[model samples]
Target: MNTRIGTIFAQEFRLARRNLWVGLATGILGLFAVVLGVFGAGQGAALDADALTLTAASLATLSVYLIPLIALLMSYDSFAGEIERGALALTLASPVRRWEIFVGKFAAQSLAVGVAILLAFGAAGAFLALSFGTGSEGIAAWMRLMATAFVLGSVFVGFGLMLSAMAGRTATAAASAVGLWLVLVVIYDLALLGSVMAASDGIFASQVFPWLVVANPADAFRLFNLALIETAPVAGIDGLASTLPFPPTVALAVLGLWLSAVLALGIRRTKRIVP
Candidate 1:
């Protein structure tokens, strides 16, 4: 809210926009959206009605991973990269508070990623409507998908900021962020599958497994989105046919706690670097 913070926020936005990678990533995602939309349209004619619904549901499900990947890419360099280059110290030496710096940087990164997602979804939705003449239900489903994607993106951005704040170098931060994504979005599920396979039939189906799955941010995102879009049955997730009661509210609370804690740690870390 202070002028100093506003200045830092503006600087962050400028840096993000000027970054070529940001531009490239945005363009690529936008293109992907258009292509997916076109595919959705083409499949409408040949596919049975129920099958088309499934396809849309699947695409919505896939967005859980898609949005987070994009957010991770945007935030991979939020803080550590500057520190690595020896610029972070000079930046911190300014009159602005460390929290201000973190908030500004987070906002800028979030805005950039949000824009990319909006563009992608808008293009995709428009194409689907124009090509297939999808009706009100289709539009409503897409809206739910968009809402879920936003939640998913916010979770990742918070996570990426935390990783960036803790890392010592740009490469380490980037690699760690990507590795975390791999584990959460993909490997974690595979590991769970293996565990279930090994156990076959037991209490594992109902008790600890459900709790363990919620602990995973990716799983939470998947469950929340799947629930929102009414596609949980399609995912064939046994036992967890839908997200638990109040899962969306819980997800938002958990994500906010993570973000606030990380930002606090980051500011503390920054303060120590100088004081």
Candidate 2:
């Protein structure tokens, strides 16, 4: 990392630490993790397949919504809010490159969210280990889930940053971020369900179903994490994975693409803003 970018990154981290909303949001997520972990411990022994499976499934389901929401809210103000408050002009007046500023902000926000996830899930894992001695298999599964979650959150951070760069007002950025979240997390699946029903046996369903799943980062994240469980049936996910044209590796690649494309576009968009 360039010295300038590193400075900006550190500054953003300090800002995030001081932000009351960021602290509150992380606390809520940590609370959820501890609660789920305790619930899983109560289900059976911590090492039990049923307990691990249930805990993973519940966490994956919750993350599909919560992670993205946190990512979006964390980043929706990155550029737009600064511009709205007239701070962006002053910041850009520095010797730093525009891309450095954008990249630094993105990295800081992503790291903040990742740390929150780790703290939350880590606490749960600790509780399980102390109380019931989590086995290697359970620990491994939890690690994989955590990785998928971090990737999922990065995807949305890129997406929300793009909106923040493009929108002229913080209000516009916030509204677009929330709307995009709803589309990707909720409406996308419902639309896919309708398509499946309409095309039942049509070639569209056969040929296009897998593409649809990978197109949405949330679905891809869900599929990637849920497919990791060796013994549990992950409700709506297993059926799709069985016929998924690509493997979990490909789903992860698609998410990587999403992050790259959105971040690149955001950088370019931010550079174009006159302020």
Q: Give TM per candidate.
A: 0.82, 0.92
- RMSD in angstroms, all models? 3.3, 2.2
Cα distance off (Å), candidate 2, residue 127: 1.2
Work out candidate 1's RMSD over C-alphas.
Answer: 3.3
For model 2 the TM-score comes to 0.92
Candidate 1 lDDT, tens digit per residue, 1-275? Answer: 78877887788778878885467656766676666665555555555432224334666557667777878877778777777788888887777787788778777777777676677676766766775676666676666666656666766876787788777678998999989989988888778877876886768856667666666666665555455545323544423636363455565455566556656766665455442
The C-alpha stretches of model 1 lying farther than 4 A from their native spots are 42-56, 230-275
What is the C-alpha local distance difference test score of each model?
0.67, 0.81
TM-score of 1: 0.82
Q: Which candidate gets the maximum lDDT versus the true structure?
A: 2
Which segments of candidate 2 are over 4 A away from where they belong? Answer: 41-50
Candidate 1 lDDT for residue 144: 62
